[model samples]
Target: MDLPSDTPAASRTPRPARVAVVTGSDSGIGRATAVRLASQGMDIGITWHTDEEGAHRTAEEVRAHGRRAALARTDLSRLPDAAGVVEDLARELGRIDVLVNNAGTGTATPFVDMEYETVREVIDVDLIGPFLCGQVAARRMIRQGDGGCIVNVTSVHEHQPRVGAAPYCAAKGGLGLLTQVMALELAEHGIRVNAVAPGEIATPMTGQEDEDVRRTSRPGVPLGRPGDAREVAAVIAFLASEESSYVTGASWAVDGGMLRMGPQAGSHLESDAWRRP
Candidate 1:
């Protein structure tokens, strides 16, 4: 068949693999997601806060899959400035196809005892950071005239409350709603937005990095064990790929049925047996 006389050169050529920017890819779910996306043939942009070495290791893993990898240091607490890292990665990688807002922080202090600065920092990193980063990535995708995907890594706390996690819950809850709004608005541009809420994942945050989740136990959870980072990454990979092209504005809970337990988790527990399943 003959081509149109005015067909653009770029569109006439074969398209390259997608490129993805994953924040806090130095470890845990972030690292797992980056590698998983790479295995699917997408180039990855990795961000680290304080763990440069870990980020480099993640980049190496991406390269091991024969995908390109770029590195950047992102301090979500730094505000609007830190969000620019998304643009930086897009420049280095040639284009932006996906953005995973996985960088986060939390507080374990009692609500009443928490200092103003502490609350501000948590909200800044967990909520505002993803918000701004999404904006940067979305604008670029719009300019390129291609749809994109943004996955915000919220937590089970986004829906449920933990006694000492006031700020964390508030930020995650806000991000959850933001995902829906972004989905509604960006759908016209072929973009999709969604949230991934995890519970008791075996990550460094939970002091269970590299721990075999099968050997561990969680009595309150329906699955009777903590989740592995790879499990959460698999879900993220789906959302970031064409596999979930029709899905958006939704929250997928990758918690071993912990959310289903509800009040029964507490009411049914008896004695020391409550510590293990």
Candidate 2:
């Protein structure tokens, strides 16, 4: 029996792709994660809900790091939108070696006055969206017979409740537990699941520079400053790398000491230099 003289050498197996799909990657933490992963040698797949220009900027940075960047528009509140994102990423970049469920929604409204729709939407985006993407990514990774990592971009709200973010708190809390549950279930298959809970990081979503959110936010953090997106991305990069191979089912906080900051932070740090005049 003879075969064709040449069949493109079986497509070269695509260099054994290592790619990450980071949701809400157009700005802030998501964008930072995409860039970091690229720097660390993983092709990046980014999704943006509203920040198309920012997403493109991130893609350019990811590309600059010498890795393929697949960018898309995603609205996690829509179930179909959430589920399809991972599939699209895998199709575009060969295979998904890492999945970062980073997109989310938050509101500063009191729980009692909150409409049911508001809470539902947050839960859908922050919690359900991650679950769907994880399920899809795990299936693909398993079929490829190569284990991978799934990092959920949760919030400090997962462990410490915020005053007015009822829905955000609820969704992140669920994500915390869900991360552990998936870790337990997927360990047998060699897949790892973990979470990154960030505190008051400066991001487009928070619009912390918008004067209002900024003034009200300073008093809440012990570091006396909001975190930068790059710091959070560094942690995510560690979680996705082979260096952290022994780590899984863990929730790491990148929140400039915010979660541990108690109500007494005001007593420790004095602002006698400037008054709210």
Candidate 3:
């Protein structure tokens, strides 16, 4: 069992721990994702736009799981450069193996009443931010000469429209397509790109922080309850892990059958006149 004298010393050394950058991880699904990945042994880079306290708490949780966690402040709405946070995190964590574009914002104003700035902000946070972050992470992965994973935390709105979520829906829809394109282009470099579309999760975004989804009732959801951030994080972890090595360019719906109700509910309506008359 003696090693050959010609064997390089570097080959005898263990590979560095994998690192993951989870943006908007100050709370909710992002926080859950950071912790989940950490549980899977990834050193985490946690980012927050406005929730510094929450980000620190998430970092603590990641560390509690015996993983290193780096913290950063990132505002995706700043665009074109917001992605620099990824590089910053990579620098702090030594290397980047995964990038989770989980940061986003939205407005409920009607389309006609929506201010230009509001729409622009939504697009900048949801679409442009992921685009830039993906680009930066991909380039770093390519340079490192190792495969990587990018998971974009899209929403159920990506495929289905909500009454007051014009900007949110549009931005998520765009990110879905962008995920596919990134997968196609980065496949050559062994980078896997995918999107996770979450339904009504019991997160701060839904005004249900720390609430147990099992106790809450969601009549619209087929499961009769909202999802948990951890539930969505589990899927994200899968996508970010070697378990999904063959999976890319796909949008996995972590919804509780919420997306399936749309067509069924519409078809059950007694009036066909609204369809096309």
Top candidate (TM-score): 1
Ranking by lDDT: 1, 3, 2
RMSD of each: 4.1, 7.2, 4.5
TM-score of each: 0.93, 0.86, 0.92
- Residues 1-277, candidate 2: write the lDDT tens digits: 2234455777645457589999888888888899999998889999998879989999999999898998888787788566798999899998999999998889888767899999888999999999999999999989978689999989988997777788899999999999999999998788999999998777777675223333454655666677878889999999898788888999999877887766565467566532221
> Please, what are the lDDT tens digits per residue for candidate 1 over residues 1-277?
2225587777777777899999999999999999999999999999999999999999999999999999999899998899999999999999999999999999887777899999999999999999999999999999999799999999998898877788999999999999999999999999999999999999999899999999998988889999999999999999998888889999999999999989887787577653332
Off by over 4 Å in 2: 1-15, 209-220, 263-277
Per-residue alpha-carbon lDDT of model 3 for 87-197, expressed as tens digits?
999998899999999999877666778888899999999999999998999989999998899999999889988766788999999999999999999999999999999
Question: What are the Cα lDDT values of the candidates?
Answer: 0.95, 0.86, 0.90
Candidate 3 C-alpha error for residue 245, in Å:
0.8
How many clashes (backbone atoms < 3 Å, residues ≥3 apart in a chain or on different chains) does model 1 have? 0
